[model samples]
Target: MVDNVSKQERSNIMRKVRSQSDLENVVSKALWKKGIRYRKNVKSLMGKPDIVIQKYKIVIFIDSCFWHACELHGRMPKSNTEFWESKFERNKERDAEVNKHYLSKNWNILRVWEHELREDFDGTINKIVAFIEHAKK
Candidate 1:
């Protein structure tokens, strides 16, 4: 499918997209306030996890509903349906692969959906804290 924008324009637009999202920053700040120290988007990691605590071999992923194709909240775009579908499918596949890789290495993996955080921010943060604490054991 041909893109609506020129290749250079599309590249410029895509380049403006930041690796770390505001949602991630919010969650990370909350976790830090709770005294949890972690690294964000470690490029050396297989999937460049959103949060990682090497001390506990833990990794947390903050997934967006649109990007991760959340079962409850995900929706297809009216335009470029096929491209979006393929992109989402590949995202899901990569997520699965990353989970498998971490699990094989005995790393604790937590995937929090965007809606989960929006619906219950405190609860989600607590869950993440609990997950980290449990991994400490």
Candidate 2:
């Protein structure tokens, strides 16, 4: 299917798309305000988790619904359906692999979907807080 916009316009729009850590920063800021400390985008970790509390051995991932194939909100693009489907499928497979890596090491992982944060910001924050608290035990 042909897109409505010109090629250049589409390129420009895609260029402006948010980088991976944009949502991660927002969540990190909130956690900071709550007096929780964490490291952002630590490269040593598998999948480079968005937020890491090294002291508690906890890693947090703020996954975009579209990218991570959230069951409720993930929708393949109308155009390039096969391409998008394969891309998302790979993403989910990689996520599961990352989870397994951490789980084997006895690390606590908290995955927060984009929609979860958007639909209930405070609730999402509370959930992370609870996870941190529980992991501390």
Candidate 3:
């Protein structure tokens, strides 16, 4: 199956192939343990958030530091600076567009960078839990 697609096309489909971070996995587990249920990437939703709580009107995005341009850890690769720059820029644009679209529909957006979330899983979860709780009210 992997060999069926051209390398470039495969890259486009597998773009931003960052694996789930410890923070996301841990926090997600914790949330589940707390009986908080959410959907992962509803195709109908813009940007296909990592976590979406439709009832609570909340969306969560766990962005990779490298892919989403982590404020602290984001770095430009020297190998193909132009290509990476364009890619990152496009990602940023799409993110902003999706964010705006979600907001327009009265959905609260939470974007957590990989570095921040992994480095501080508890705090991140706390924020999400709190958001969900507040949204319920």
**Top lDDT: which candidate number?**
1
- Give per-residue CA lDDT, model 3, range 1-137, as digits (tens): 12555779768877865555565667778889878899876779888788889987899998888888776899987655677889999989999998999889988888877776667877878878887888778
lDDT at residue 66 of model 2 (Cα atoms)? 86
What's the TM for model 2?
Answer: 0.86
- TM-scores for every predicted model: 0.93, 0.86, 0.81
Ranked by lDDT, the better of candidates 1 and 2 is 1
Model 3 deviation from native, Cα RMSD in Å: 5.1
Predicted candidate 2 versus true structure: per-residue lDDT over 23-126, tens digit per residue: 77778889999999889888998998988998989999999988899999988788767768889999999999999999999999989999999999989999
State the displacement of the C-alpha of residue 101, model 3, in Å, after optimal TM-score superposition. 0.3
Q: Report the lDDT of model 1 for residue 7.
A: 79
Model 2 misplaced regions, further than 4 Å: 1-15
- Candidate 2, lDDT over the whole model: 0.89
Q: Which candidate number has the best TM-score? A: 1
Residue 103 alpha-carbon offset, candidate 3, angstroms: 0.8
**lDDT of model 1 at position 44:** 96
Give the candidates in order of lDDT, highest first: 1, 2, 3
Quickly count the clashes in candidate 3: 0
